[model samples]
Target: MSLPRARFDQFRLAMMLLTRLPVGRISGAVPAMDKARWAFPLVGLVIGGIGWGVFAAAVTFGLSSVIAAILALLATALATGGMHFDGLADFADGWGGGSDRARTLEIMRDSRIGSYGVLALILFSALLAAGISEVASATAFLLAGVGSRLAMLLALVFMPPARADGLGRMAAGKGEASLIAGTLVCAVLVILAGTTGAFALIGAGLAMIVIGHSATRRIGGQTGDVLGAIQLASETAIWIFLATSAH
Candidate 1:
């Protein structure tokens, strides 16, 4: 296949996996996850762009900032079908309740939410909504989305998979190329957001790295749940940073 056509197929696979958007239909076999690894950040931008529209429209319609923030969160969630949120919850529960790798992996794979999962979701979500409450522009809101997903992609590249077979392994090959591609996308976002955007991106990226390291130490490597948790933390960090930088 031509390079552009191959790239288009990769992006379509990304959208099909990470979002609820309709990307029509593709011919032939589905692309592998690794080919689209670098495109995760781009998918986030698309999701965030829709979310920014929701937030901007809410504000324009005379809604309060808090309500607008809630709308924005809802829009993002709807777009992605809350898959990341599920991962975040599973990571929390598995780590909080398990003492070892086998137990933790088992816990994470269960389709039930435990006490730790519930608390983690509540706290992270509250912070995410609060951060959204302070989003002052479409740029900041969109940047947060790109930054968070970039964080997830970076984790996939920099960290090892906790298990032998999983999304983390299939979605990335631990190459710097994917990292560079994702970072370039994030850099564009930061440039568009100004100095504050740069600041927020730095803060968010640090938080994601920290999460990646912690997951490595705890679970021996990264898992899909860990990626989800990283995304949540990174996005929240950016929002908080944006709120602080706005001051």
Candidate 2:
């Protein structure tokens, strides 16, 4: 029998929110990681939608572009409970502080943040904020929302699971068809936004591929934390590219 469509939608919504969506909360009771994997991109769409709305509001308010960008960034981080930020920090700490791959992974898994991780987080966050501010166009910001999430989708497509039994492994390889469907949808959204958006999407895709390859080579596979790091890096990369392209 086919899985229920409603259930699938719920799963998608849940995966996007750091497993905090209502669909995810319900699914949490049943414990199905395979469903969660397929649902991730859908969840990304929802998150992107929220970010787009915030950007729209900022633009409508006639706030300074920098202030609008800062608000949008904060909305994303807060909505997701800084899950991706944590991943970004951990990955930075691991890669920057460790001498080898094993040590790096070990360091990433640790709860403590090192100086390298802190610096990386600060730098990345500032770059993203500044980049978004420079764009100053509602269309560009919307495209950015879509582009960043598309990067996350690409990461899921390219990376392998780092651990045997964690969330990453469960959701790693199950939904190529679903992910492709989602990417196509995101592409349409980007194209609709403008030429600049199209360029941002292309840049984000390339960055994701490069990052995925590097992460896989370094650690042999992707973890949930790696997925988070991918999203954070890709989002920042998109903003940076858009900002430069705009100038």
Candidate 3:
């Protein structure tokens, strides 16, 4: 296929995998998950745009900052089908409740949510909402959204898949080209937010280290749940930095 066509297919695939949005259909041969990794940040941009729109609209309609933040949060959640939230919950449940690798994997695979999962969701969701409410910058939202996904791409490229099968395994082994491409795209998005991106980048880096190391030590490598957990943590970190520094 032509280069541009291939890129288009990859973008469509990335959107399809990352969000619940209607991306129509790919015109020709579908690309592998690895090939589509470059567009992950693009998916973040789309989500951030949705969030910015909702928050702006809510605020324009005379909603309080908290209400606007919650509305924006809900919009992004709906856009992404709440998969990241579910991942965070599963990661917490598996990590907190399990004693060994096999047990952890088993817990994560279970459909039922546990106490650890509930607490994890509540804590992270609260942080996210609070941060969004405090920092009302469109640039902050866009930067955080893109930074979190960049963190995901980092884990997928740098870490091994914990299991022999699953989304992580299938999406693993992405080339450096994809990583570089995603990073460049992410850098452009972050630069648009000015120095605030520096703090957000620190947050994303810390999240990648903490989540990636813990996942590696506990379950041997990264998984979809781990990636999801990382995204949430990174996003929260970005928001906190933006909020605290907004003054």
Candidate number with greatest TM-score: 3
**CA lDDT for candidate 2:** 0.70
Estimate TM-scores for all models: 0.96, 0.85, 0.97
Candidate 3: list runs displaced more than 4 Å. Answer: none
Query: What clash pairs does model 1 have?
Result: none
Per-model lDDT: 0.85, 0.70, 0.89
Which regions of candidate 2 deviate over 4 angstroms?
1-31, 59-62, 136-142
Candidate 2 at 69: error in angstroms? 1.1
lDDT of 3 by residue, 193-226 (tens): 7787787789888988999999999999999999
Q: How close is candidate 1 to the true structure, as a TM-score?
A: 0.96
Top-scoring candidate (lDDT): 3
lDDT at residue 106 of model 1 (Cα atoms): 94
Clashes of each: 0, 0, 0
For each of the candidates, the C-alpha root-mean-square deviation to the true structure, in angstroms, is 1.3, 2.8, 1.1
- Model 1, span 52-122: residue lDDT tens: 89888998999998898889888898899898889989998998988987898999999899999999889
Off by more than 4 A, model 1:
none
Q: Write the per-residue lDDT of candidate 2 for residues 29-121, one digit (tens) a residue.
A: 453555555455555566666666787798888987778778888887877788888988888887788777788788989989899889988
